[model samples]
Target: MKKLLLVLAGLLLVGCQSGVELRHGYWVDLRHPAQGARPRIKVIVIHYTAEDFPTSLATLTDQQVSAHYLIPRQPPQRDGKGVIWQLVPEQDLAWHAGSSFWRGATRINDTSIGIELVNNGYRSTLTGREWQAFSPQQIASLSALVKEVAQRYGIRPENIVGHSDIAPQRKQDPGPRFPWQYLAQQGVGAWPDASRVQHFLAGQTPRARVPVEKIMDLLQRYGYPVTPEMTPGQQQTVIAAFQMHFRPADYRGLPDAETAAIAAALLEKYGAAE
Candidate 1:
């Protein structure tokens, strides 16, 4: 009897080890993974928390808003390297990128990983709004994290974008002070070719008028969500979002020749869909 009980226990243990039990009296063999499926992650969205690390941590972990990762303005060092926080697991969805659209994908939160940087955003001063710059150490850590994530998921350069780029009409978290060009240089995101931009410029001055309609088409082609029904002011917000990523020197939402040229250059290089 004792020998029979031991055998039964061993058989149950072997069955449990061999198959994953489902809640509804089903068992799945995970030894053979389905080849037809793909990684859910398609894009990487960067953001700036308008609060410090402690506040950002509390908000991301406890509040409705959350991100996969949180990068401090000044990261804590470990083994002579800066360390970042991972609030949410990569396999799970986070509540970031609220009501966002990118390329042809809507509800961007479903298919993208969010990385929030600890930044004060901007303070309204008597002169103007002063934007806080990200620290070098912070950017270094962020670049490493972004590169690893992009490579793991085989994400395209154009797919790595700022929060503002995904939701131009309502959001502007990673502002002008964010070093997009520098990050692009580190193979984490896209940057328009200067020569291509000049080709589109065609010797046109910066202030030269480019048809607003044409600019809108170029922006839409590059994956910015610009609808024909949007007001003129609303359209300018989209342009400003693009400028904030590619041309951080100024982002007044003007549809100048230079802005149009940059948009054209990006389309030529990246070849967006619709």
Candidate 2:
């Protein structure tokens, strides 16, 4: 009887061991299966490292700064397996999107996944432009990553944003050359509807038709952190962030016909969707 009991206990242990996987350890509990909360990933915040590959890696890994993934500005490898590096696991939090706000969420690091791209940000001079453009390989990998993450976490299109979009006053990484339109075309993020933009623009003079208060209300309604009583400087910073995402052709931080049109279009589409 004792020998039989020992054999049965060993078999039960083997069955439990075979049924579960734990990192560098062994444990088993048959309480429940497929039981856990869904991934808490609510937003995907894109950024540029503003440095070379090696430097970016070191800063993101060694320094306090970190992200869920890092895509270097390099061609895809033969196997296409190493286009991106997952520095931090998806289940963990990364110290990116510092002191940022979006759509009533503040300090968004708590619910956002950050992806850092390799490139130098914009330079001061125009003739001697120093900002490097993101490569095709990088964008392709980014699209795949964004789609995969969004599907897994049920992240909405409008939730895919840049660091600049969250922290407009301080950061502008993944700048105008980040190929946002391409990502939108690939169904990675939200793009302004052309008809809505045209409707906002057609037969409209930009002198002073829409009151500033109305514009501010619409901007806030569209997820920007704009307040009516904001200082002029603060208002410009927020507007510039909007332009960087929507109307990259001009991010001068001043409201114009194009800016108004784009802003209204975004509000009409995503405001309703959200």
Candidate 3:
């Protein structure tokens, strides 16, 4: 009787462990009530895993780091359809934005929801290899998700940002390849008026002066953390990140006449909220 009881106990333990493992595989919910008053979810920051699907799944579920959702590269079904996996609940902070800031708000994970997509970023580039484009199905799913989250939390369209936007000095995931213009056309995020910016750039005089401090101030107003104490090199890099998102013509880190004009135009458009 004692031997039989021991065998049954071992079986039960194995079964429980298997169940936990299965739950950890994908779309596991990690919601826990926050210790303090609930802050508003005003931003929806997007990121790319910079890893394959299996690795992303493991990392997100390990309790060391997490995001609210993970969109798989390949469709979950054998029929080649894409799926979005819900990892952490929207109400919980998911260790996604580390030591980050936006528009004077620091430690963004407390006030934002993060969505991570599985992509290897630029580090996985191979010579002569074509980069993979975001699948149509994936984009459709992401659009729907963003609309739902934005409406649910009252998040502004401009608040949907890439991880690179918040941590320009330290990180660059969801690279230039990510479709910002498409999302803007769908009314999910902000996009500057390209024609007006171009027109302003064209009409600049050779002796015309640009207020560098004012441009930087506008960037700060638009939720970029630029300080007066930043070194020249740091300032250049931050400007480059800004251009990467908005201009995309060239991220040369130089605030030339054209760049300044574009920045000024953007300020005119979006700085009212600031």
Candidate 4:
């Protein structure tokens, strides 16, 4: 009876302390929270593992490369969730994106979550490069995972991007066939406004003609690695990257009417938001 009374007294004492909780015999104050200048996280960069599942696991686990999570192509049924294999802790910096930049942020691995998807990357063909299609099931799983991570980190939809979006010069994983539009429909990534695109696509633009400088400005506004000083070859790579994300039906890297329309729409929608 005396021990019971002492326990009640201790509970009463804790209940009286302002904004304090006695947890595991330790008093924790809830008033003060740790403050930081930049958000601990700001983006989620998705990738496609160039090799198969086993090779991907081996590579990501290797000291030379790493990622926060890995999703295999032939994922086991997960009752409707994405097949996620955690390779690194969320708090630790993963060496997945090498020499990456986006939205003025360099060395992106420091402030982003990397998700590596099991894929063949790309196939070299007689004509040029051929991209492999992702499984519907895998995409569904990825959609769910993307939503959860984005919500947890308060990451904007536009900030969820492919690795190639950050490093177009030497990287193109999560290629054009990756169905970014589907993810965008599910509210995971950014997609240009269809009405606005249709307006430009129908050749009913407000301007008499859109110039190369306008297209470049739109691409830059949408966060592509493009600049006025870039060489023609360098600019083409960035344009190809942009097309792969927004206008996958035609990604020849040339400034076509369709590409310009898509770029303008994206600029009006996402760039304005940013």
The candidate scoring highest on lDDT is: 1
Q: Give a tens-digit lDDT track for model 1, residues 1-274.
A: 9999999688667767886444456556667788998889999999999999899999999868899999998899999888989999999999999998899789999999999999999999999999999999999999999999999998999999999999998898799999989988888799999999999999999768778899899889889998979999998899999999999888998889999999888888888755
Q: Write the per-residue lDDT of candidate 2 for residues 64-156, one digit (tens) a residue.
A: 899999998874576765468999998888999999888888888889999999888877776755567898888888899999999999998
Query: TM-score, each model?
Result: 0.89, 0.83, 0.76, 0.85
**Could you tell me which 10 consecutive residues in candidate 4 have the lowest summed lDDT?**
203-212
**Model 4 alpha-carbon miss at residue 86, Å:** 0.9
lDDT accuracy of residue 137 in candidate 4: 74
Candidate 2 vs candidate 3: the lDDT winner is 2
Residue 164's lDDT within candidate 1 is 96
By the lDDT metric, which is better: model 1 or model 2?
Answer: 1
- Please provide, for model 3 over 1-274, each residue's C-alpha lDDT reduced to its tens digit, 9 standing for 90 to 100: 9999999678657766655222444433234445895448988999988889999989999979999999876646545545688899888889999978886788999999999888777645456323356666667678878988998888876788888788989877677677888888987877878786777678776225466675576677777878889987888777777877776656656766666766666666766335
Clashing residue pairs, candidate 4?
Answer: none
lDDT of 4 at 242: 85
Q: Which pairs of residues clash in candidate 3, taking residues 3 or more apart in a chain or in different chains? A: none
Indicate the residue-level lDDT of 105 in model 1: 85
Q: Which candidate's TM-score is highest?
A: 1
